[model samples]
Target: MSGRRGEAGSALVEVTWLAILLLVPLVYVVVGVFEVQRAAFASTAAARAAGRAFVLAADPAEAQQRARAAAAVAMSDQGVDGGAVVIGCRPACLVPGSVVEVQVSYQVPLPFLPDALGRQAPSIRVHAEHTVPYGSFREDRS
Candidate 1:
């Protein structure tokens, strides 16, 4: 009876400790995963939006400007910083039947990590590429 009484509270204490130990890591992992997912979403949307903007622009200079602006907006909407957007065109840009490829890339810092860690901190890089085709019958602005 004395032994049972002593063991009664031991199980509760053990469980509480175990829960605290397990839950902290579990919560950290979940937050990291969510942040990476958000970055992925932002990159994908940025690439798609930038590609479309590039193809719709009236001039080469405007196309580049619009592509960057569109990509920045898309990334910002997902709570990510304005990332890099690189555009490449097939043969010639703003030409009929040409295809424009836009790539969006950014790094997702680990959950609860500070920038002071610099490159030493673990981070996940997310990249997305989208291609838009200028209509065959459209006027060539190149």
Candidate 2:
């Protein structure tokens, strides 16, 4: 009975160690995946909002400014910071039926990593692009 009791404790210790070694890392990986997915969602939303803002603006200069602001706001809402945004227009901007494209890029750092290590770690980058057409009813300014 004494030997059997000792062996029972040993099995529990082994299981505890296994959980520590395996389960913890698994949980971290799952959380990291969730963060990356969040970044991806943010990027897509930013691009779409920027493109729509650009298309709705009345002038080319205003379109660029609105697109940038819209993208920044969208990304910040999702807990992402310092994301890069790019905007492009087909043919000429502010023209009726012109297509506006907005792209957002975000780098997601791994959780629990030190700054130096995080910088060295392979970053998960999420990119999204959206295109919207300008209103066809707008009168040509030129």
Candidate 3:
């Protein structure tokens, strides 16, 4: 009976060790997935907002400024960096029926990863694009 009593705690110790090793990694993966999803959502929203803002502007110069501002605001609202926005415009963007395109990109860092391994760990890049067409009623002031 004495010999059996000492070995009883051994199973509990083994189980605890296994749980720690598995659960920690599982939690990290879940958090990383959530971060990626957030980046995707932010990028999409930023592109849409930028395109719409550009089409509604009074002139070409104002359109560019407004698009950038709108994209920045949209990304920031979702806790993403707004500096990565890229706007692409079709020829004669202010002309009637012209198209305005906006693209937003974000790099999502891995959760609980060391900065030193940043190069080794592949960062997820999320990108979204939206195109808006100018109204047919737009007047050609030039």
Q: Highest TM-score among the candidates is held by which one?
A: 1
TM values, all candidates: 0.93, 0.88, 0.86
lDDT of 2: 0.85
Candidate 1 local lDDT, 71-137, one digit each (tens)? 9999999999978889999989999999999988898889887667456677889999999999899
lDDT, candidate 1, at 62? 98
Report the poorest 10 consecutive residues by lDDT, candidate 1.
113-122
Model 2's C-alpha root-mean-square deviation from the true structure amounts to 2.1
- For all candidates in order, the CA lDDT equals 0.91, 0.85, 0.82
lDDT order of candidates, best first? 1, 2, 3
Give a tens-digit lDDT track for model 3, residues 42-91.
88998999999888788778888898899888888989876477776666
Candidate 2 Cα deviation (angstroms), residue 51: 0.7
Off by over 4 Å in 2: 1-5, 116-121
Any idea how many clashes model 3 has? 0
Error of 2 at 36 (Å): 0.6
